[model samples]
Target: MISITNLSYYLGSRALYENASLHIKPNQKIGLIGLNGTGKSTLLRIINGEYQADGGTISKAGDVTLGFLNQDLLSYQTDDSILSVAMQAFARQNELQRQIDELLHEMETNYRDELVDKLGKVQEEFDALDGYTVQARAEEILEGLGFSTDDLQRPLRTFSGGWRMRVMLAKLLLQKPSLLMLDEPTNHLDLPSIQWVEKYIQTYEGAVIVVSHDREFLDNVIDVTVEVAGAKLNYYPGNYSFYLEEKALRNEIQKGAYENQQAKIRQTERFIERFKAKATKAKQAQSRVKQLARMELVDAVIDETARVNFKFQFSTQPGRHILHLDDITKAYGPKRILTRADIRLERGDKVALIGANGRGKSTLLRIISGSEPVNEGKRQLGHNVSFSFYAQHQLESLSVEDTLLDELKHANPTKSEGELRGVLGCFLFSNDEVFKKIKVLSGGEKSRVALAKVLLSQANFLLLDEPTNHLDMQSVNILIQALEQYEGTYVVVSHDRYFVSQIANKIWYIEDEQIKEYPGTYDEYEWWMEERKEQEGNSKSVDRKPAPAPQPATTTPRASDDERKEWQRTLKKLTQQAEESETKISQLEERKKRLEAELADPATYGDSKLMQAKNDEYHRVKAEISQLQDEWENAMLEAEEWEKKLA
Candidate 1:
């Protein structure tokens, strides 16, 4: 548990937070949200102790631990293997294993009763610590984050920046600290991996605070929402959808109060002005002035910021057939990523390319764009198919020396200065911001500039790979709207379901070296997938094969009274077992916490004999606790099965 009181932070002259206070309770999942410059990441850094708050007090429970996903992979030790780095999270488990080894050796030579007891205790401690499964858990986390088994043995330096960040994420998840703080965690993940993380965080035993621009991800993972705006923090008691509704309600109420207060002020001022000159009414006018000054004005609701309003401008249309690919096969050495894929794109078509990470989604896009060559395929472009390709890596390709205005101009030399400036303004680069060089811009700013250049190109076809990577929700919405209106043929690779649903008219799903096409909206595709999953669940065998063909019914039969009573008795026993197991688990958890705290105390390490006895008892209790947890889980599962049968 952590508490923040009167937290204040400043970036130069801009006040980010002023007297912002928030309390994070155990098992609370909070979504930290705001606009680009509102300091959500800074707040996370302050909480993680990487940055100091200008004025605030942050208090935490004495035994609480923190885990933060490191965004900067450059600081990692690249010389080490990926698995080795992830295994570092299990420092305590490794230490206990070492102690167990020493105790075992001591017992072999001098087999005293106390030494044998100590060895047994140490082995139990090792098991309780999950020392045996540390490597397997690390592998599971890594695989879930999109790392292959071979990649685990590879040196960290061999991975690119994005993959390295995944490794860091794996390390943090393995740490399983008391509090986990993540900023834009889904930014680097694909759709499947993002869903995996959502499930993981939902079930995580500790508190979580996440900052992300992915609205769908936030809606899935967070139970509490915190908005950072107007130099204050506002709390909402539900997920992002609930927060939006509640925020709108509050804004409406605030608008009404503000309007009433302004009306009262105007009335008071008018009365004072009209009566101030008259001698008879001078005293009344002075009282009115005092009343006006004493009134507590209500704060106005914050208005939505100006959004980018540019659309793709095309001078010429492409041929009816924009692009075509036949028998496309791609592979990296021995591993085949894609095989015999055929696709076609027509003019004015908008397609969404989707798949898990490293499943050839981006590769297929690149091949279609003519940026990557296929191993065995032919790519054909239609006549007059002028196009612009925007890769995620291309965001960093803008010349650092070029200003925002110059970048747009370079994208289209024919455009006059006025036209270029107008386009820049549409992307929220107004006045002096247009003069700022690209090198000094933040990642989001650079991304906006890149998008502006792509718009200026006015190509009839567009190939976009992760265009919403650094974009905020509003920007993504604007881009989606623009793409929807454009008459160009486009294929976009995106993980943002909302954006895809708005812009894509068709879906291209890549899975297991094959490309599947669905002629429907993203929402429709989602519904179809859910329906298929439900059908599968219905057909799935539950611990047994199908029954053999039924014999001719001699007579209609039902359960006897005795059989019904026995079934009811069994159900009741299962329910009772579930309740009792839950109670015991809670009590044992409390006792385990107390014992852990005592063992963590520095004074406990001073006396070897006393420490040994306490540790032996601690390990015994922990082993029992593990067994009890297993039984508790089984009991709950059995109870649910019985309830389902009764239903």
Candidate 2:
């Protein structure tokens, strides 16, 4: 556990925190939420001892281990493979194992007394720490984070930045420190991998502190929320949903108190002015003045809302067919990302592309937008289809020296200077901010400027990749609203489930070197996924044969009730068998329903192989159901015969 008391920090002339106090409990999942520039990352650094607080007392319980994921650190080199990098977390254990091996080798050669004693102590220490399973644990963590068995042996340098982040995450998970701190940990993760991380954190026994813009991830993983505002920190018990409700109630109370105090101040001033003109009321006026001076003034809380807003204006409607891709095959050397792929997009379609990291979601997007070439495919754009592309790496392409206003103006040459400034103002850049160089802008500011420029292009079809990365919750919601209202085509690749659910009308899922489409919201997609998992579990369970029925003894019954007793026994056995058969049949039927729904998803329509596989599964289950029914009928017939004998 860690406690921060009366902590104060400053960044240049701005006060980041003033006397902020917070207590982090053991095994608590905490979410740090606040507007940009409110010191969320700075606070994390202070906890990790990377940054020293100007004035504060930080206390930690004895010998607590801490691991902090630094987003900006590129210390991991290319020469190291993913497996080796993850295994580095167990360096101490590995060293102990090596020492024990050496000691054993020495004993076999000469049976040295000193070497034997050293090995005993080393073995004791290793056993106490469960050091024997270190390699297995590391591999488990790596695979859970979506690293393929083949990828584990590949050098880290060959991986992209996003893949490198996964390696870092795997190391942290394997280290199993007492406290874990992550800033935007989900940024580099795809949906499936993100789900895997969520499940891992839920089962983690240590405390977790994450600063992220991902609403759904926080909601699923965290139990408490901490908001940094007014140069102080406030804690909210429960998840993000609970925090939102609590914040609203607190804001209402603060607003009422602020208004009441202002009213009282105005009343006192008016009474003093009226009485000061008359000598007889001079004493009364003086008393009133003292009363005003004694009154406690309430300082108004600063507004913490993000002012950036994006609005798209449509110029004209596109043709029926928006885009068409035929036999698209792209690869890098031996690794084929997309192979023999075909897709067609119609106007007014809102689609979400999803897949594991490095599965060509972005590559496919680039090929459609004409930003990247396809190895063997034809990309055709329908008549009157105007497109605006928002690349995930757009930040790198921006000029740091260009002013925000100048950038917007350059993108839209026909727009007047006044029009450009107005657009920037809507995105929270005003007055001196518009004149500031883009190079000096924060990540969030840069994102807003990029989006602003994209909006001005007047393109009907938009392709956005991770558009919500640097945006706060408020800004994200605004963007979602704008995208929902736009009367055009949209193909977005994002990990934010809530945002995708809100705006997308269809989903494109890439798996096993193929792309599939689903026509529905994210909620529907989730339901279908759960059903598929249930069906798989049922199939595995049903592979074994049913247990044999217990046989009745052939010995004669007691003379007083021989016939009745025999009949009763036979009926009981038959009834029990029928009941068991019915239960199994019901379970299989439920599983079959789920499998049918999964097969119905639009994304699966294009894959003939998967469709055939699903169909075959359906038939297999149907045959099983028929067999179960026949068994049930036979059991019922046996029960009827026993009942007649008893009668």
Candidate 3:
């Protein structure tokens, strides 16, 4: 329905696109992918006419409606109810509705022939436009995007930023334009909302162009992939996986050609060098030089940016049982989230927490991380456990006044400047980027910084909530690789099925106020769910009764009074040990900070003997700090376990 012929665009001195062209056909779903700042959004804006291309012709079919979901908020609806905002998408239908009503009112009052004829005509138009069902359709889309019935009446200003984005998305979906352009439509959506969008786009009659970091969503929705790199656009005939395979195949062929060309050039150069002065080879040498000048060199197929290289460094190894939750329940007044949820996590276990929106996946992660208290539950951290948490909103904790480098430096003041820069480099911040303040960073940049902070902490356990929310595919893959290699236990709550499948060995599915554990990967869990669904359908057909519940197991005998008293002493001793260990860790960190400061000085490097001595002391202090941290965590975990037993 739309075509771009010889399109060219520029951002100041940078050429975002040069003679790039592509055609978008009706009912085609295209995924636009590139690194950050590669003009994915810029190209969308150009297509939407928000920005004119430097030199390009974007021709559209006559009377084709367009809906572009950029960051720009819809105008003049901040105080309106969400339903009212969505209903406005059907302005033509609303007008038809009004005309029909007017004609009916006129016919009822005057009973004239002209009024009756006009009423019939208006009703026909309204019926053709589906005006009568617009309200119901709007409500359905809202509900699919995770809004409750009551939420339809609430003003848009009452919702959080993420929820408000959903409201805008609902309006766009309701509009159902001929060409829909969505830029990161899945950024703030939960699993159910994303699924709704996936299904909607798959069945949508119009064409769609989306720029998303969500690999799995794209794989399910898009039929074509447009890759923007190196000031050029490449089209893949299939989805993301196919794009990968196809790109590799093309690169291999290009590489072979490049190698052959280089070999011929080398042979020509050798002949020239060996016989340039001889009369027999003069013409050939000149011919080879001309050929070299006329040759079109092939650019090496390499990543535009460096991949992240880092891993979670653990100071201590937790016990066999990493965590245990007994009879856990959580509720907010009348709305219960989790009920009697009992779970045991073992060391080295990677669990993916999956559930619908508002179904307690994040709530469960919070409860395990001890950031939120359970209404009724007894939980214990195993001995030597030390953990870090990354919440979806964790980026909000960054200081606006600090630069990216400063914020990371504040986390570990003892880290040398060079070491800190190395970590930042792994996260893709370098040169002047390190000096950019947190307030100026984009959401994805902030998320990357938050993640880098989490990785730098020496924790044996990781509790992540929507860690991939704003990350690009490259960053997500980097994280997946790191987590896959991590030696500690982790429980991640993510809606990215591809990422979850890459990292999780087990699945913890939350539904109906209960947690169900599946002992397999995400793909396996999907198969298991499908099989169970089939079994249930067959049983329903047979009209059989449900099976009986199993009998409860017998309890172990209680401990004697002397044993309990010894446990009390042990708890007291552990508490004191924890306090002492913390003090030692603090002392070491202070000494390490001094050593790092000394190392930062140019004068210290000038004296080789003194530099070596300080460096030695720095290494010793770092190793000691790691040991002290392990001791501290071990003491704290043992104390918590003892307290649980005594209770």
Candidate 4:
């Protein structure tokens, strides 16, 4: 457990955190969320003791170990295999292992009672520490984080920065310290790897504090929300979704208090103006003036929720069909990416391209954008179709010496400065920020610049690769709004499920070296895929053998009439039991949904005891529903058996 009391941190003359207080309990899962440049990562570093607080105190036990997985770890290079690097988390175990090995080697030459006793003690400690299984455990975590089993033997230096970050993540996760801190852990992870990490974090015994922009990940893995705003750390007793609702409620209260105080100030000023001119009520007016001076002002709540109003102007509307790829075959050396893949893009399709890493989603986007030539395919562009491509690598292409205004001006020279400024404002760059050089911008800032450029391209079609990367929740929302208003076709490749679910009208994935399309939203696509998988599993499990040729039905005393009647009755009873169980599950599900809605209310969060009680009830209802569903399944199976016996 750790307690940060009245913590203050400053960046230059600006206060990043002022009198911010937060109590972190043991095993508490907290999501540290805020807009870009709000010092979420700085707080993490402060907690990890990389930086000292300017004021106040951070108190924790001496033995409370901290495991930090940060972007700086990406630069850590080692010739050691990734497995060895991850295994290094077990420092004491490794040293014990060395001692045991040295003792065994010495024993080969000289075996003594003291040496034997030492060997036994070391071996006992090793086994107790589970040192023998450390390598396997490290490999499992690395693979879960997206490394292949073969990749475990590969040198850590050989991987890209993203993969290297994952190796570092695996190392920290394996360490399993008293407190685990991850900053933007999902930035380098694919969907599967993110999900795996989510599951791991949800069950981890150690406390975790994560600074992430991924909404769904936070909702799934974090129970507490700590927001950095107005140089203060605000605590919410629930997840991100609850925090949103709770913040709205608190904002409403603040708005009312602010309005009341302003009205009182105006009334006092009027009284002072009216009576100060006269000698009769001068003392009372002066007293009111003093009262006004002593009154602490309530800060107005500024809505950080962003909406993009800038229309993405295009020169011309593309034809009904934007582009088409027929029998596309793409390969790099012996490694094939796509084989005979066919895909069609329509004029107004908002498509989300999602899949695991190494699946060539970017390669496919490049091929579609005509930046990459296909080895074998017919790539056709519809009439009057123009496209702009945005990728992370495009940030490098930006003129670093150019100011933000200059960058936008270079992107579209025809647009007036006023018009460009308006568009930049929509992307959260207003006034003086537009003059900041592109080189000095953060990754999220650079991403916005790139996205703004794409919008300014005057192209009818856009190919965006991970456009939501490095963006905060507000920025992602702005993008979602911008894409919704844009009158064009775009296929965005992203691992952000929440963003995809919001903006995507259709889903695309790479399977069997072919681009596949699902004509629905991401949520719908997931549902359909689950159903398809279940059906496929059932088909594979079911025997496809031909039925035995039916001989003339022989009554041959197979069963007595009483026996048949009894079997039918048993089947009916079993079916009835299953139906009752199903009904109970449905009721519990509705109850659970109701509780969830109530739990999201700010009033519920105000009461810690009520919050804990509701949470316990919610999870209990979930377990009850699961148990009932399983029982229903067993009952159905029994009913089917009875029916078969009757037949």
Candidate 5:
């Protein structure tokens, strides 16, 4: 519905995009991805008209509307309830409602035929928009995004940045814009909320362009991947996983082509150099130089993948047991987070703490790190154990005035500046980037710096809460590699399933205010959970009471002659209805097949009117087919019931 052609945008003098063109088609699910500094979010802003492109054109159909959900919305707050905020999406409907109310008041004060007519028109329009159910729609979306029913009436200002972001997301989803552009939406959502959004986006009628670092979420929701690289938008026909494979193959081919081109250039240059001074071959050498000048150079493939190579070390090795908690009871005001909960951690344990939001995952992390106080219980640390806790709030704790180099030094005074720079380099802060002040760093940059500090702390045990929050896919991979190589015990809370799956061997979740463990990988845990759900479903569906034995029928009275004839007539009519319904269904199915073929034709795409007509008719035909099928089934069912009665 929207076309971005020859789009060029700049940051200072550096070109973020040059001649980058991307066509967003109707109902297309697109994953916009790249490294941290790439302009994924900027592209969205350009499309939403918040930022102007330096050059080129962005065209949208008159019918297309846009809704954008970005991190900047985290600062949006009001005393109004969240439901009220989300319901604001229905501007037209709300106006119509107001008009209806005014007209009704005017009728009570001074009745007029014109007033009645206007009221009727406004009410009709409101009903046409399904205005009455807008509140329910808002609530459904808010709850789907992890808000409770009671929380809907809570003021938006009461929520944290992440929760407020969810409110904005709910508002956008409620708007149902023709093209939805989301920037790192999954960063603010929990696992359940993420999955809910995935399902919703899969069925959404509009086009979607999502910028996210969550690999699993991208794969689940998007059908296309667009990579921003080399000042160009590269399109992939499939999801993130497919993009990875395809990019690898393309890189290999590019590398080969580049090498061949370089060799050819070297050979041509050598021939020119050797023959240029000779009288007989001078003309030929000049011609060769012209040919070299005309030759198109194949650009070399640059591998930008960041790697973590630093080993995690501690001054003292802890005993087998790292941490233990017993009968822990914790509460915030009247809301009890954990009651009589107990958990244990051993050395070398890699645990992924996960669950829906407000389930005490972070609270439990704080408790384990001894940062949170418990109402009743005992927490003990093993011998020689040292720990570092990394949380989102820690990003704020960073010294904004210090350079990245200085920050790492503060984390560990013993580590030299060179050693700290090496650590920062592994986190993708290299060369002059280490000299950048912490205040100038982006969210992902700040996160990397904080993580580097955690690493420099040389702690034997780590409590990491949502460490992947601001990280891009590559940064997350770096953290994964670091954790994979570490021998320390750590419990990390994350909603990014792919990140958790790669690094965690054990799954931990809070249930009934108690910490529960699944001693397996993430995939295994998922499979087991699905199986458990199925088992529970089957148990609920199981017939609790043994079915009574079939009783034999004994009939003494025969139907009267009139009654018998009436019964026969009813059965015959039912049979005829069934046959007629079947015929209609067959005809509709045939019609549906023809429409599908026409819609699939390439020529249809060339004509917008024809394409729209076919699409509308396609849905109409499908709905008709479904209705006819249902009627046919009902007819057959009635015929069967009649037969049973006669028997």
Candidate 6:
């Protein structure tokens, strides 16, 4: 367990945290969330002892270990094999193993009783630590993170930066420290790798604090959320979804209190002004003035909901056929990236391109955008189909000397100053913030600014590469909403499952030098994945089964046309029942909400009649809701069976 008390940190004149206090319980999984530059990573660094806090204390239990995986720490060259680097996590255990080996050799020749005893002690320590299984564990983690069997032997230098980051993640996961601190752990992961990491974290015994922009990942993996905002920390009891609702309620309460205090202050000032010179009311006026002096004015916190809205409007509509890639073949020297790939994009199509790191997802995006040429194949862009491309390494393309506002203006030369400012404000940059130099901005800020510039380009077809990399949950959500409403076509390469779930209408999975399309929402894709796994398990079990005795084949059950029609009718009835039960559940939820609101009123707090009535209503609604849910589930199962039989 770790405890932070009265913590305060500052960078020059900017305060990151002031009197921040947080307590992390043992084995608790926490999600750290905040706006850009709110010190989520800095706080992690302070906890890891890599950076010292300006004030206050951080206390940890005896011999507590901490592991941190940040973007800056993963700047390793690719020349090192991924497995070799992952195995470094067991350095301490390896050292102990070496000591054990030396003692064994010494005892084997000398046969001294004292030497043999020391050797036994060393071997026992090694066995207790599971040192022998270190290599196997390391390999398993690396493979789960998307490194192929052949990739284990490939030098790290041959891998891309994203793949190198995956290697670093594998190393950290294998380390298994008492406390794991991960910032954007899902950034470099593909869907499958992300799923693997989620399963691993769920089963991990140690505590975890992850800072991620992916809302679904946090909701699935973390039990608590620690929100950093306005130079303070707020803790929520449940996951990100619960945190969002709780924070909204807290903000509503704060705003109400602030308004009430302001009203009181205004009333006191008016009373003093009106009665200042009146002889009969002079005492009252003076008393009002004193009261005003004694009153501690409430400082209104900025409302996050009031942030600028981003709505991209483009006058020109793209051609019905946006892009066509025919027999595209790409290679880097001897290694082929894509082989005989054919893809078509139509107007208003929102597609997500997903694959493991170094699988050429970005390469395909570039090929379609015409930024890179295919080694073999023809790519055609539809007439009047203007495209805006956002690269993962877009920072290198930006001018460091330009201010954020200037960059936007340069990108949209036709836009007026007001229009440019409005666009920047949508991305959370406003007023003086727009004047900050691009070089001075944080990575997340630069990402936002880059995205704002792209949105302002007025392109009907957008190609984005890892656009959510450095964004926080709030910014990502805003982007998702904007993209959802945009009429333009989108081809994005992202590892953020939540973002993909929100915006992507189709998923193009790239694997083994090919792309496969899954036409559905993310939930459908997940269901298909689970079904495939179950099928594979069943197949394996069948393979292990003994041979069956030969017997005469019996007639298979064949329903007549009338029987099949009756089965279909039953299936329809079951489906209707399921839907009706779900509707009842929704109605109960609405009643429960109303009952809770009434129970929260102060007038009903101590009234025995009101309390009993509200409690009864609450229990009744809950019981109905539970019963409806059960009925819905059973109805669904019956409907599924009926449908299968009909099929």
lDDT top scorer:
4
The weakest ten consecutive residues by lDDT in model 2 span 302-311
lDDT of each: 0.84, 0.84, 0.85, 0.91, 0.90, 0.84
Name every residue pair that clashes in candidate 1. none
Pairs of residues at least 3 apart in sequence or in different chains that clash in candidate 2: 78-157, 516-603, 517-602, 517-603, 518-603
Taking all chains together, the TM-score of candidate 6 against the true structure is 0.78
Once fitted onto the true fold, the runs of candidate 2 whose alpha carbons sit more than 4 angstroms away are: 276-311, 416-418, 543-647
Tens digits of per-residue lDDT, candidate 4, 565-647, equal 88888888898997788678768868987998989999999999999999999999978877876677678668758876776
Per-residue lDDT over 1-647 for candidate 2, one digit per residue giving the tens place of the 0 to 100 score = 89999999999878899999999999999999987778999999999888999998889999788998867744567697788889889878888988998888878878977887898999999998789888788788888888888888899898877788889988988998899999888888888888999999998999999988888999999999999987899999988889988888888788889899999889989989999989999899999999988987776755444344445665444545688787788998898988888788888899999777778888888888898887897998864578988875797777888988788887778788888887777666778888989889888888888887887888889999899987877667767766876788989999999889899989998766667888888889889989999999998988778879989879755445876787788889888987787787777777787778868977665788888888888889878877876777678668868776665
Looking at model 6, the pairs that clash are 78-156, 78-157, 79-156, 79-157, 80-156
* Tens-digit lDDT track of model 1 for 343-365: 78877788999878778888888
> Quick one: ranking by TM-score, best first?
4, 5, 3, 2, 6, 1
Best of the two (4, 5) by TM-score: 4
TM-score of each: 0.78, 0.79, 0.80, 0.83, 0.82, 0.78
Model 4's alpha-carbon lDDT is 0.91
How well does candidate 6 score on lDDT at residue 188? 73
Best by TM-score: 4
lDDT by residue for model 6 (84-177), tens: 8888898878888889878877767788888878878877888888988988898888888888888898898887777888888888888889
Summing lDDT over every window of 10 consecutive residues in candidate 3, give the lowest-scoring window.
303-312
For candidate 3, the per-residue lDDT at 77 reads 46
Over 4 Å off, model 1? 101-118, 272-299, 305-311, 413-422, 532-647
**Candidate 2 residue-pair clash tally:** 5
Residue 520, model 5: Cα distance from true site in angstroms:
0.9
Estimate the lDDT of model 2: 0.84
